[model samples]
Target: MRILNTIESALSGFLFLLGIVISLYSVFMRYVLGASQSWATEVYTMLLVWAIFIGFSTALKEDKHIAIEFLYDKSGPTMKKVSQVIVFIIGIGFSLFIIWTGFNMVLTAYSQQIKTIDLGFPIWINYLIMPIAGILLFIRFCEKAYKYFVKHEEVTHGGDVEWKQ
Candidate 1:
């Protein structure tokens, strides 16, 4: 899990930097060189999609995903733990569904031999991010679920408790 997290984080960071470089280079090519690079936009778009989906999973694992924690923070220990469990279970199920559907889409595109306009690559190569994201999401949620089931809970002195990842 640790190694996977590190790889995801590094890939996310690299894609982000590479995306920026691509965009800047595209601008320079268009404005300064007076010649447009047709492939730049398509590549940048693909990079953006990959970066967001991949980085999203890492963020979810790190508990950086956004949520309405106000009510959770004000909840009692039992309620807080229960809410977390409910949320994680729902997330796991949703992720599984996404994985199933995404894999189907990838397979369909592959069978159809769909190709990208600029890159002339199989479009499935682009849509492949969907299942990859779903798998990462599933793993992260399962890890959280495991923690919820196996880890000892923190007993609080206050009436309300705040739950962090």
Candidate 2:
């Protein structure tokens, strides 16, 4: 899980940087050179989408996702613990839903022969990251659950926690 998180973070970072570079280059070409790179927009969009989806796992691993902590902060210890269990259940269910929907989307795209406008690659190539990232996210959530419930570790990856167990 550690290795998977590291790889996912690195890949997402690389993709984000590459997307930025591609967008900047396209801008330069269009405005300065009076000619745009036709494939740049599609490629940049694809890279950015992949980066965001892939980074979801890293964010989950690090506990960096945004949350509405107002009610949680007001909850008691037992309620807090129950909330954690509920959160884990929801996360797992959401991940599975994403995997199923994403798989269906990929199959539909493949069957329909959908292609990108500029690059002409199959649209599924861009969508392929969804299920992969969803699986990684599910793994991260499981790791969190194991650490909290089995290992009895506090699940705080450098986040502010106003409540105590």
User: What value of lDDT does candidate 2 attain over all alpha carbons?
Assistant: 0.86
For model 1, how does the per-residue alpha-carbon lDDT over 33-116 read when each residue is reduced to its tens digit? 999998999888888889999997887776777776788769987897788778887999989988998899999999999998
Q: Supply the TM-score for candidate 1.
A: 0.89
TM-scores vs. true structure, each candidate:
0.89, 0.92
Candidate that would win on TM-score: 2
Report the lDDT tens digits of candidate 2 across residue range 41-156.
99999999999999888888777898767877788878878989999999999999899988999999999999998878999988899888889888988988887887777554
lDDT of 1: 0.83
Quickly count the clashes in candidate 1: 0
Q: Candidate 2: worst 10 consecutive residues by lDDT? A: 156-165
What is the lDDT, from 0 to 100, of the residue 101 in candidate 2? 89
